[model samples]
Target chain A: MSETEALESMVGGEYKYGFTTDVEYEDFPTGINEDIIREISRRKDEPEWVLEFRLEAFEKWKQMEEPDWPNVEYEKPDFENIQYYSSPKKKDGKKAESLDDVDPQILETYEKLGIPLQEQKQLQGIAVDAVFDSESIFTTFKEKLAEAGVIFCSISEAIQDHPEIVKEYLGSVVPKGDNFYAALNSAVFSDGSFVYVPEDTVCPMELSTYFRINNMQSGQFERTLIICEDNSHVSYLEGCTAPQYQDNQLHAAVVELVALEDAEIKYSTIQNWYSGDEKGQGGIFNFVTKRGHCRGDNSKISWTQVETGSAITWKYPSVIMQGDNSVGEFYSVAVTNQRQQADTGTKMIHVGKNTKSTIISKGISAGESNNSYRGLVKISPRADGAQNYSVCDSMLIGQTCGAHTFPYIESANPTAKVEHEASTSRVGEEQIFYLQQRGMDEDDAISLIVNGFAKEVLQELPMEFAVEADKLLGIKLEGSVG
Target chain B: MLEIKDLHVCVEEDPSEEILKGVNLTINKGEIHAIMGPNGSGKSTLSKVVAGHEAYEVTQGDILYNGESILELEADERAHLGIFLAFQYPVEVPGVTNKNLLRQAYNTIAEEQGREELDPLQFEDHAREQLELVDMKEEFLERSVNAGFSGGEKKRNEIFQMAVLQPKLAFLDETDSGLDIDALKIVANGINELSGEDNATVLVTHYQRILDYVQPDHVHVMIDGKIAKSGDKDLAIKLEEKGYDWLSKDASVL
Candidate 1:
């Protein structure tokens, strides 16, 4: 998108990327229960053990309560009112004739959303990951991945086709009874991508749950699993910059990653869910739990997210360094505008000797929104020579918005080292004037300043994601300030 | 190229306290003018007002660039018409490379003038060429805009930007205030090199040190928010010897 388009969107306080893809869909009835979970598992034709896993998770969820500690105010989402599963109609004679019969409208929408033509063709699953890697160069890409023993497919497909790998790593990083939302996801989650990079191999294609769900009507409980074996590498992306209509007001997704010795997994997310109207009447409530485990020495896992939407967001994509010399990183840029509330950060748990972690977060709040960076860095007593560094910076646009930073750090090991730095800056009139005097208009000046403020976190994004994220920030904050 | 007709200005925060009280000045192309004044005498205020700083309100009169009144333009609009003000204190823009802003300003002005914009590689070469004009190192272009820069380095950066933008009417506000002798020479050389027949340079200063390096065609001393006296380059030399006390009395009488 052009800078002027970004400026115009910010001035109007409107979501810039919203389009619909017309397709036949079959959805489960609204509400949550053991029967609904059984029906969802039965519909997917999951294996008996997979159904048992869901049944156990459902019992665990029955004993749990919704979390209330997040620094956000919103009406509790009625679990009974949300449909447990929905997808494009999948049955005999309901499927399209040929694999090349991909919808053109989806490609048009992707182009309008700034996806390159090549990417549109290459990464065209266009569903909540239904029949992902289905056609086109997808065959070649899959062949390339198969040549390296990389298993990439929908989680349901993975559970049926690659049961051994799924059984070994599923819920290993984030357990079924870990939290309120995660337990709910484990019980009745719909479709999400599953990736497995074999030992001593590098995945040839970037994996993503692009448009994770096609008709995300009632709610989305997507559970994603990724496992990187020894000496393996994989880069996974989630979500997209396109603004989703999101008729469903709730989204609870779970993502878990496991990295073995010398393995590295880089995961990035660009969340641009609907953030309601100017008055904050309706929007998506995004509650997700994402965590990664460095299971062996010299392994690494990094989480980079650009969160610019959702009326109320509560997520902490974190990492647990369990192996000596393992590394973890969290780079995030969370922006909230127009009465939106975002309470998001990361947690780094250094458990083994010589583990290291780094956290850099930038928060921008505008239009009376509330944005907070709440993070924790815990170096256990046995983590000798463990190190952690964190920097959380906040920027306020208008007078009514708020930006907060809450960093909880603990270094129980005497030899561990930890450093934290925080700063809060407002986009003052003087700084605007300085840029304007150099020939940039007001919107351009604000865009430049915001980009400068978020540069460190943005540089951590992948190439295409970085470009889109920069444009997204420009669209969100350019004209929000005077 | 610039004409200030009985200009009166006040801070928008305090509109009752006029800072520039009926100031009059006319600058022509190829001429270098020096405005020397004491503390709170409105020399800096005049530069800021001409650059259309929103914090300052022009209470009366008008400013004309190339004989067209520009009182209605915003700072960036006036800037597109080739008016530049090098601030006494350049604001720090952390994480934004100096080259980024310079190329943006350069391309914008080029497009405004109906000239083709340079691509990134071409612009990088063009930007590096201007660094030599300010006697600045190549690394300066890679650093954040004036963030953590020394005072002298910041002043040189202002001139470096002036060279890149190539404004028609440039206001150097205290551009030489905090420089040592060696740094002052470098800044003076930069100012002298950029000054040409097509553009006018207005140097706002407190002392005669910079004027000795880059001679001015006219010198004016401001007192109590008005230009109290106007003369040739010798006027700056005279003020350096006698200070503004002698001129403050004459300005009050006028």
Candidate 2:
């Protein structure tokens, strides 16, 4: 169209955060050390014990080098130079009454992204936690959810109001030293969603978080914790998008979930961060660590994600089945267009008897993008008669794109049954011709095919988020198909 | 409305082995033509070439639709010009429902002709009406495109699409290959109903049984990629009675 306007002037065309916001921030100067970790904990007004946890995590992070195992390549981030604590000027203290009370400019960013922020904007039964920049702006349907005795609010507020519950479950699933990015997240995580469903309570609404990175220079480090008590059930959805910029921004996040006896949790994510231009400059370096611990018998946890953005993505939402009769599942559709690269999959570690897990991954590679699925299913001797099934399929759009799958399965229990299936296919020219011959244009044909390929994973999303995810996938494959 | 001149095409993967060797044919409006030949005699190749299939290299052919050279047009462009082909083996696309697909196809062609797209409700009504013409069940529209469909059901769905598309020049590529007697009659009847005063059809079949129901306007015996004999409808009866071996032996004289 017209000459590429400043990221601030853009309205929409797939990348909703193609606009920048005029905002100032109070942030930590680049570099990571014990002092920086303490400063972050102090800035959040956390207890001394929490500060110790951050310092210990910083030490562990220093002992470990940056992971080079992923199929992505990027210059090592100078941790000391990066601002770890960045928040809006003085409005950080102002609590939003509802989505309307949130900054008009911030609301405009979400509107440009087409995310529904009002009560009527929500479909059927999805309750939203809208996180703007480094803080949770407003959470809807909280009063109705209080009737069910479920505590769903911002992590920062949870720490302030429900410190005991937060202290009991925080890091219980994902330890501070889980990974390099996780440790980094523990040291400087700003704010994310906190969810808790009490025993025997079925949450009344689908809990959701819509993360908007408004500031161009801000690095979003959000830490989320979810806990489901015995016989409790909840479904949580997360959607994230960032403003477009010329310099690559970093987003390191950690999400942990704990499901006790007979509890179930379903976590869904539609990640559509601005993936930069075709030449691959100025995108987000998304390194996230998400894990769930099934600590109760017959408990279950499922993670489903549709990733169509980020220039370099290093993520593996995994599950640790530590209780007998627990179940874990991971369904994902990761699409890499242009010069993007993603190395994602899942890990299912069976530590208890009769546990089971399933992983289904579909990767679509277009343009010069590289997509990979790396997974592991480990069954310990104590996990008697454990079972695991993993299916990973990759669809390549063009010859220049690449798709790869790596499965590492280790079983100490002779009775365990673990099977894996993987296939690499190029969406056949015949398939497109068949659709076009039926009168569909080439773009429509490709979108139909890709949607069909990703239907299994898309079905796992909440109804409201699923529609947005489907449209986002369609838009992401625009120029890459032809 | 359809014309093929000195059509010489070869498999793109193997250029030395020619598929269609200088075949020539012209089909006018309102005519139902039957193309019968033995397997590997380029019966399918000729149909694919006319529909602008990309696999076969049309090295020396010129396909014209209404006096315009269509050899350079894309498959979709050819479709916009009222060319439709019922694939011998329908593709199974999971998560894409038949109703959604038909509506998209119908509206795309309509838009290409400078017509407004049918609204969602209108499309459903039109698709439901078209499905009934092929004796298809209403449930077929809700199913994934050919996913888990039976042989007969898939064949009927193809005809259902034909009825909905209403192309001026339709190519039924062995549409009765795996159809049972009942399905064969239903498909044939669907085709016959869709063939009208301004449109035509090219029935590509190996068996003469389908001819018993649809009754072609002209029957052409294909031998070695060329139409060996072109005659009236009775020629199909002759071929059915005497078998293609007789034509193969006599056509060698040419």
Using lDDT as the measure, the top candidate is: 2
**What are the per-model DockQ values?**
0.81, 0.67
TM-score, candidate 2, is: 0.88
lDDT of 1 by residue, B1-254 (tens): 78999999988999899999999999999999999999899999999999999999988999999899999999999999999999999999998999998898889878888888999999999889998888888999999999999999999999999999989999999999999999999999999999999999999998899998999999999998888999999899899899889998886676
What C-alpha RMSD separates each model from the true structure?
A: 3.6, 4.5
Candidate 1 positional error at A280, Å: 1.4
Report chain A TM-scores, every model: 0.90, 0.93
Say which docking band candidate 2 falls in: medium
C-alpha RMSD in Å of predicted model 1 compared with the true structure: 3.6
Tens digits of per-residue lDDT for model 2, A130-248: 78777777787888899999999999888888989888887887788888888888877888999999999999888888887776656788989999999999999887778778878
Pairs in steric clash, model 1: A128-A212, A128-A213
Residue A78 of candidate 2: its Cα lDDT? 68
